[model samples]
Target: MDIEYSFNKRPTTDQIIELYDNAGLPRPTNDKERMEQMFENSNLIITAWDNELLVGVSRSITDWVWACYLSDLAVRGDYKKMGIGRKLISLTKEKVGNQSMVLLLSVPTAIEYYPKVGFKKQESSFIIEREQ
Candidate 1:
């Protein structure tokens, strides 16, 4: 697949929602406005595209010099295991450089996948759950 990766290239809300839904990744895809805001508020967005089709995305909010919270990583179901997600993260790290570290909260299904991509399990992390 001739996939092209780009930084800060925001995919349309519909494309993002479709990808998220197709990948079975949990996100507020039902609310288009919130989805739009999610992308709009993100400072770093890495997207993988096959021609015009949005195949994968890695969205994050980062300080560029301190830490990066990678809030989402999604790829079309058909495109999974093809290294699209890995490339998106690799590109994100390259852009942020070594001064900052990438961090994320993995979904249950993806819990075993993160460590394979160089993320060490951090036992000291804590979170205040978001009310649904």
Candidate 2:
């Protein structure tokens, strides 16, 4: 299908919203606020686009010193298996550098995919709901 894409370290606001929305993943009601925090706290984020269309996204929170978390990776369903996700992961990891512990959350259906991109199981994370 001639998928044309590139990895970007700092994408525009429109690209961020578009890819995150098009990824079809369940996100929190505060996704917009959370994304703003991510951009502020994260050392780097990678956005992949197929031509001009926002198709994939992956972001990381890292210190480039000890630890990193590869969070919020998603690609459009129509763009799946096209290496867009892989490319985003690669770009994030490369930016994190070696000697950093990297991690991510994956669904049961997606567990196998991350290992191929150089991730492994480490520990479990959780969230406790608070009254809103």
Candidate 3:
């Protein structure tokens, strides 16, 4: 099935949670308000659709010139291995252009996947763990 991709098309909370859950990405799915804020706060939102079904999404916050933090990249389980994730990242890079760098914090399971999609593992990055 061909996937239709779009930019800044903020998905409904339901669609976002569904994708996150099915993709095995840990998110506050039960908290509707938090999910709303997650998408609401992001500036760059790319989505993939399979004839009205939300199958994949790449959400990021960026300056559009300096750096892009790709916060979430999720695709439904059935859609995995079809290069949907790769395409989402590629489209995101296309949007931000060459001057800006795209960065992400990979979940333990996805550490290997990111490098395959043109991400170079960096050693100098640091993060203060989110207080849950």
Candidate 4:
């Protein structure tokens, strides 16, 4: 498959919702407004496409000098195990350069996947639960 990758090319909310569903990544697809805001406020977005299909994405917020929070990383279920996820991460880090470290809060299913992509496991992070 010839997969194309793009940076900061925002897909429509409908496309995003479809992709999240197909990828099995749970998100607030029921609330289009919130979904739009999520992508709007993010500074970095990298997406993979198979022709017209949205197959994978990596969304992040970064300062380019200190820290980069990779908020979302998803690959369509049928497209998994094909290195698209790794490439998205590679591209994200490439854009951020070496001055900043990339961080993400992994869903339980992805805890093992991160280490293979060059992320060191950290137990020092903390988060207050989101009420929603």
TM-score of every prediction relative to native = 0.97, 0.74, 0.97, 0.97
Q: For model 1, state the Cα shift of residue 5 in Å.
A: 0.3
Cα lDDT of model 1 by residue, 8-127, tens digit? 566889999999999999999999999999999999999999999999999999999989999999999999999998898999899999999999999999999999988999899999
Candidate 3 residue pairs in backbone clash: none
Model 4: colliding residue pairs: none
Model 3, global lDDT? 0.92
Task: Indicate which candidate wins on lDDT.
Answer: 4
Cα lDDT tens digits, model 2, 68-130, are 887688798788888888877777767777877777778666888777877776677686855
Off by over 4 Å in 3: none
The C-alpha lDDT values of all candidates are: 0.92, 0.71, 0.92, 0.93
User: For residues 1-132, what per-residue lDDT tens digits would candidate 3 score against the true structure?
Assistant: 889999956678998998899999988999999999999999999999999899999999999999999999999999999999999999999999999999999989999898898999999998898897
TM-score comparison, 3 vs 4, better candidate: 4
